[model samples]
Target: MALLWWEIFIVVFFVLAVLLPAAVIAFKPQWVFFSRGAKKSNAETINLVRTFMTHYSLPLGMDPLHRQLCLAFMDPFVKTVYSLFAILPDPWMVAICRAVDAFPGNTLRYILHAIIGRTHLIDHVVTEGIKRAGLGRCQWVLLGAGYDNRTYRMAPLRQAYQVATFEVDQEPLQQDKLRRLRKCAAVPPSAYEDVKYVTCNFNTERVQDVLLSANYQPGKRTIFLLEGVSMYLTKEGFAQTLAAIKELCPDDCTLTFDYVDERVINAYNGRTDIVDPPTPPLGSPRSVESTTLDEGMSDCEEGAMVVDKKTAASKKEEVASRASTPLTAEERRYGVQYCSVLERNQTPVTFGLDPSRLETQMAEHGYEIVQHWSPDELAQQFLKWPGGKESKHGGEIVSRACTYFYYCTVRPVRGSAV
Candidate 1:
């Protein structure tokens, strides 16, 4: 007997809901890193694909860059997943992302878009650092660079500055990346002239020694890209890694990274005031775009304040009466939901900074904050562009989640080069 249309639909949904995820997990075990690992570097591949989807679905998607960087690295199974997401309609695809979450706002689409825009921001920051490194003739080092294809994607970088290095902890993922690079004919051997890959556990190994053994030049300045990596580390691990960078590199070196704010790190309830997600300059197409919540405001206490949307709405009058400085109706509902989603994740933020003392704190560590961009700042910048199609999509995501993260570029203080 033939089944009815609704029955068939139910059957297909059941298969996809149960069998598909199980198949993905079994065949692509690395995908688990996207959801529940302490060391989630394994999920970098999954993250890369999500970023690819962000570019794939949007008008501003830099098809060329993502295609060159990500598409070539995906295995057959991953390729199938990518194709499915890419082929589906935008709203339907976005719903697929959102459906993963029980709640509406904290959807997979939001997270994917966040990854895409932020990755673009990182790309721009690293590109600038690369230019500086080229001028200084320093080596480019990507610490904890997981599934990062920047070395392979930017032909100009390859042609101009040849020295590059990618350091990762996991051997399997590193091996897989290497294999994929070899498979993808887009980047030939001549393209990656002086590249090196170092495999060492940052927690236990001396990162300095690992690089030194890899023929990394100690006297030369270096461009360090430490993206999406610090928070997972223990306090001791974080300090040790920073110490290694200080001890090994010269003062002329440039370091670009993003971090969680102390407020978010130690938020007791889901009520931390919004801090802008980290962001970069607006010079390049890939650079982060944003506006200031208030002029010269460095922290939440200043003019830009964030409050829990649900709580603030109920206590608007009471809150306004209690505090001389109260968040506007908009500011409380404003900002990215990224942190709220992160709070729900199994992996918790272990370290963060106090924005008020950022400059001083960095100074104490022999580093100076060259630039800092909050999420609000980034979104404002994005909205300023004339025909920023991608920027609009990315700007919205960041604007919503900006309070959850912070971005900055830091350089070693003179006479304190590590």
Candidate 2:
């Protein structure tokens, strides 16, 4: 029987995920995937990709192949196209591998980095952060973890027999993933004895209750990874989530996650094509001749002619005026406000939790910043592609203009846990 369009698309995607990185490693390793000076060799790239795929193919009470195929196919193409357009600054391939999961293909759940690069970036960061925490033997929690393979892939965690890992998400999604995993990999029960899955709704469910039900103890030192999830939540939700972590885990626990600055969120909101005018305004409707002229212009000139701030703002206001119901007072408050609502009444306001503000918040929450890496600094460290100088338009410039922050923090404010 012939397959459906989406099924064909998914299969083709998996093929590419396996093939593209392999091709890059075999033929154009340096140019296609890595920055100019990255130390990773062709052999390392091939091995890493293969290792990730092998582990990803495993069944840990979840079916991930379908989701993996979807991600393997969609993420790289989207990220590469965006990078080619200079709309994305970070390495697109890395972002895709790090953030894309096998369940819930909702584009809204992932951050810009996730959307434009390989999802493995999160995996890499988390592995590094785990090592930095020096908690090789502690329990680890992967909050909102969707098809995360760290428990299987990371060597340290695999070797630490005493360590336990908890993977949490909404129950329905988790069940769907579990079903898929069972069908695809059929992992032996013994292999997953130390890893547990928990289902909880971050907005309505109590974290403590969920952990206790999953056999997680409040007194154990834990490491938590909350990646590519905060932006989807309201501010209240994020704070409550954090507070729950503090309350549930022992003092020596550590949490790592990423957050976007308000400016970045606003920029993303402004760039969404959903609000684009259906037709040019009556006054500016173009004639055939004008349309021809506009189409004939050089790429540079056409790019330059694209809407500026004033024009964009005017267009937004026009769209707002045309809508039957204008943006709510709540909606107009920016994405952060929406996030604030999710945390319930406990709103911890920081400037995207900038270093200074993060320090203050950590103190109040009985946590301290053990490690912090600014997006700008990370871009500088990882994104080695220098911008094209000869291009008249500045679009080719690889600016470290990221508006997100990633950090790792330890709990209990000052003392080590037994």
Candidate 3:
């Protein structure tokens, strides 16, 4: 009995030794800081996997050579992880990829390809813009730049254009990233020269003040790379950030960012799994139901509105009933599952824009769209699979259906439009 108990204890100890750290990392993004600490995010992990995939996929003659070079500039840990996977056999890799929830089997190929493609497209556009306008006179600003190594990798552009990358996030996360960077052997001392690290919550921070403090010149022609950040912010926060950019950046300064479509946010058109809703303005009435939009006009008039004077669930309900469309059986299932997952993760996606309203929406914030690409457009242009007709079309269909990612470039509209 004593020997059997000892064996069980040893087995339990080993199990925890392997599982505890993995669980911590897997659930890091959902963790609340008690004493101010940085936890891993889904975005960070996606970046790592994407970079690793890029390194592997490059030799396959799938992606552009320059993109492969860019991957070489990634964080040391990312590179190390990629190197480990690169040495692994295809069977082993497929098994590991299959085990991941986000990317199952060969689906990872399309996902990684799309990510790398979008990244390459952005880099090409920005670099070409810089080259055209004279590199030595330009400035590059990567907003919400998390673990992105573009500044360090673009040797020619950085040497000439004088890049200044700013990463704004919670202090704890910023500290953790900087700490990692310091420990990275792949990064050199000179890599620090062109980049400036700024720590602030973008939703609350004054962009003008933050930029000025970071030695950013508002007058200089700048290229703002706002990648993978919009969905994380509320609508007001998104608008405020854009307004700050407009007020602070030069008229010609270009801004590029990706956003999820409003349809996806609302989980419309069979996309019931996406959890998102447009964030209403400040002082907006709170809803008992979080997903529904309060679109009804108030009879109380603007300033005369009283706070609890309206336990008026009836009025709100009437308005919602009038304005809200009924959901289908499929949609209801998708919504329930999506919301359940969202609540479990403790992260609510509260911002999305209708693509049809893109031009008007951007113009409202003093920005005019220069170019845009949908998921289908991106896939048709960039995705290439190895097999025959059936495989290619199937992959493209999967990629096209993924309308969550979009790329758009905009410039500050001058004159009365602002």
Model 2 Cα lDDT, one tens digit per residue, 1-418: 3568889987787556544543443332234423323222221222233223322212211134323432332224333532332322224433343443211231212222322222343455455444544444457788887655456545345444456778888776556545544544434344444578899877788787898898987866676777656655666677778788877864556576766544334433454533322433556632211011122222221111233446444433332232212233332343343344223323222224333244555566665554444443344333333234564422231223222334333344445322
Clashing pairs in 3: none
lDDT score, candidate 2: 0.45
**Each candidate's TM vs. the true structure?**
0.66, 0.49, 0.64
lDDT of every predicted structure (CA atoms): 0.54, 0.45, 0.54
Quickly count the clashes in candidate 2: 31
lDDT of 3 by residue, 153-229 (tens): 67557676655556555666556656665665566657654467777677888777888898888867777778777
Model 2 TM-score (2 dp): 0.49
Ranking by TM-score: 1, 3, 2
lDDT of 1 by residue, 1-418 (tens): 3568889997897677544753553333335434444334335554454444443443434546557657665555556655655655655644554344223333222334345546666666666555644443657788887777676666567457665554555677677777777777667766454567788776688888888888888757677777777766677776777777877774556677777655544443454565433332334232222121222223332211233545333333221121222233333332223334344455445667655455666766787655555554444432222244665544343223334456666666668733
RMSD of each: 10.4, 18.7, 13.8
Point out where model 1 deviates above 4 Å: 1-42, 53-60, 72-80, 89-110, 132-136, 268-348, 382-399
